[model samples]
Target: MNTPILLLQCLFLVLLSGPLFAQRWTTTSQESEQQPLRLHGSLLFQGIYPGFRVGVERPIRQTDFQRSNGRVNSHQRAVLFYVGMYYHPGFHLNTFAGAEYIFRRVGGRGLITEFRSSLALSRTFLGAETYRVGEAGIVETVLASGQFYAMPGLGFGMGKVLGKPGSNRPFAYMVNLNLTGLAPYNGLALPTPTLEIGFRYQLATTSVHFRHRIRTRQ
Candidate 1:
């Protein structure tokens, strides 16, 4: 009975100390400082093309008058607006949505439009560090759980440094690619690909620091 009790006591002590040791290790491995939350917004322009079949039941009447084949131009223009929050120096959360206006001449005198929305996770590295007063870093971002036209989607993007770092201002450029599905209200699914490129500028405010001097009198 004495041996069993001694062993149980030792085990209990070990278990209690495990969490304390783990906490200390975690604290020392990374910076303990937390960055303040920041808000940012960006505008984007993209070009998209259909990769799969877009089922149109009726033939476009305007195409009938054209001298070329019946296939109408499938290219479209997309505009995106994003609002983002910086939670850390290397990580951020963002939400973005946009509309794609697909114009197809119909009945020799009409046009049609298609709209889409997307939500994603955006990560930043060097570009993100530009907001900091000093030192440069790199940024990588991934976007998931995206919904396009009621269909599921995913995207990935990365940004790199464009010019030298600055004490009060910095510039960065980024490019992104996205894939999404398109379909009728209750029809089969179709997927499309979109590409976008854009640039961003970060401006920093200057801070003045002062030191106090002490004097001794005789």
Candidate 2:
């Protein structure tokens, strides 16, 4: 099977499994109701090779804290699933699909800090035709030449929500820098660094809307 076909299959499975996965995070019958999912899109750059990423994220848990002086803050944990593709011009084109665990912190001012870890299936397609000499001395073209790999990554980001006073803002933005590792290349692991600037938009919520009430210092 071709990598493109595999990519599509994997993406389909991910989408189909989202609800099943969310079931494990439910703490009550009310929470079992369908929750709003966030949509994310980003412009990506890996050493000047431009790319794009799109993903869906669902928040599984969240906790709020308050300062002694009356400031309020919160942290959230969520699941993110994504797919992306990038071109290296005449070198190669790379495609990947992955899922990650997100740990994010929100401050009273709407500043956010995040950390994530991910795993993915990645395929790299050659830009030029590939040929190999058979043992019989005949040259043959290699069809759908490409390489497949398992990609693991760790990343961090900082951003802010667009609105807050009304506590009804549904948009947020972020910038991330990730270090991803690829293995089985020449029997050695390789590292790739990428940067992303992105936005997250909220979809319709369930019966209960999510909100945060900030307390002013006394």
Q: Can you give the TM-score per candidate against the true fold?
A: 0.29, 0.75
- Candidates in order have lDDT scores of 0.33, 0.78
lDDT of 1 by residue, 1-218 (tens): 69999999999999999977645322112222221111123333323211111111111111122213332222122223343222222322222233322222212112222233453332222224232232445443433422223433455444443443211114444444556544432477545344545443432432222221111111
TM-score for model 1?
A: 0.29
Which segments of candidate 2 are over 4 A away from where they belong? 1-34, 67-71, 165-168, 205-218
- Quantify how close model 2 is to the true structure by its C-alpha RMSD in Å: 13.3
* Distance from true location, Cα of 190 in model 2, Å: 1.9
Quote the positional error of residue 17 for candidate 2 in Å: 40
Error of 1 at 67 (Å): 63
Instruction: Count clashing pairs, candidate 2.
Output: 0
Model 1 C-alpha lDDT versus the unseen true structure: 0.33
lDDT of 2 by residue, 53-105 (tens): 89988777655555565545667778889999778888778899999899998
